[model samples]
Target: MNHGETAYGLWSLVALNSTVFILFAFSFFKPATARDWRSFGAFSAFIVALFVEMYGFPLTIYLMSGWLATRFPGLDLLTHDSGHLWSTLLGETGDPHFGVLHIASYVFLGYGFYLLSSAWHVLYHAQRQHSLATTGPYARVRHPQYLAFVLILLGFLLQWPTLLTLLMFPVLLVMYRRLAITEEKNMHKQFGETYDAYAQSIPRFIPRLGKARLTADAEPKK
Candidate 1:
């Protein structure tokens, strides 16, 4: 294996990538509460873990080296292209960055950040008015922020599947779900029938197709 082709041990790249993504997500999500911080913190950890393996050290690759060599002897596991395991496993030739899974990962990441920004805008306004967020992306789902985080995580997984991130993904999902549920309970207590009505008409995560039922407060002002 050409030592020049080996992609790991770039600690600078790992730190740079992690900071860029974490800060980007932070600018959009803007965590305010303890729960928000906890969720954001977990997401940040996932990002750091992903980039760490991506540049600093390929622990997943190292661990699976024996099996990988046996399975695909021609493969150069130390090279960056080999890190795109989905492409390698699927027998995709040429640039892994241009592969189908990689392309789809971009879609997920783009939409995820978009959703996060949109959700934060609506949520920030609602918090200012001391009201429930049932407008914009919130009209589609009660927890757009959580959904955005999930999408981002999935995008990273698709782009580069790591042992640690794959394991953390499901656990983070459960954590976000619990946070959403707990948030809903608080909303119910605060807004009572109004929250109930909103909750009844609008689903929590998976958005309903077609027209979204909007309360008077949620309706855009003329």
Candidate 2:
């Protein structure tokens, strides 16, 4: 470790970070179904793998030692900052954690958690009522929760760029997509035309921004 980077020989920090993130995510998700468990379990595994390499060990750094040393000589490959692969690859000067991408990563993380919480609330009530979820976050995007997870994962990747996380990212994305399709099939079977119309009106991943705002006078008199 160097002045620009923190030391990563501590085992406690690694365990703490991994536990905090995994537990925090589990709290918000409250996953129950087999599919949900698989998704949540996979997400937890990714998080664990990420922190493991980031603090406890540096497998990717070790694996790519030859190439990294050849490409950028005098690199502090063992430094925690060097684990930020984007900074090294881009030859970004100054602290990698303070770079634009790192700052933007925080934005993605915040928005993703926000979306996850909000979407979960709406989905919970809709599921309880056995009705279509077409309000709140659901009004703008069909799969806001999954998109939220994707954003969160992307944020982590941007900040850390570990090989394990990078590989897990695409796999989780495909899983989420398939899960969304299965969810849609169930919704279509239940709501039929109503769900079809709602699905058609709303985008799957991208939001419609402000188009979902309700007009105060649009509702019929009680």
Best by lDDT: 1
lDDT string, candidate 2, 81-184, tens digits:
88889988998999888999999999999999998999989888878877777788887888988898899899999898888888999999999999999989
Q: Write one digit per residue (lDDT tens) for candidate 1, span 92-139.
A: 899999999999999999999999999999988988888888888888
List ranges where model 2 is wrong by over 4 Å: 1-6, 208-222
Q: List, in order, the clash count of every candidate structure.
A: 0, 0
lDDT of each: 0.91, 0.84
TM-score of 2: 0.89
- Colliding residue pairs in candidate 1: none
Per-model RMSD to reference: 1.8, 3.4
TM-score of each: 0.95, 0.89
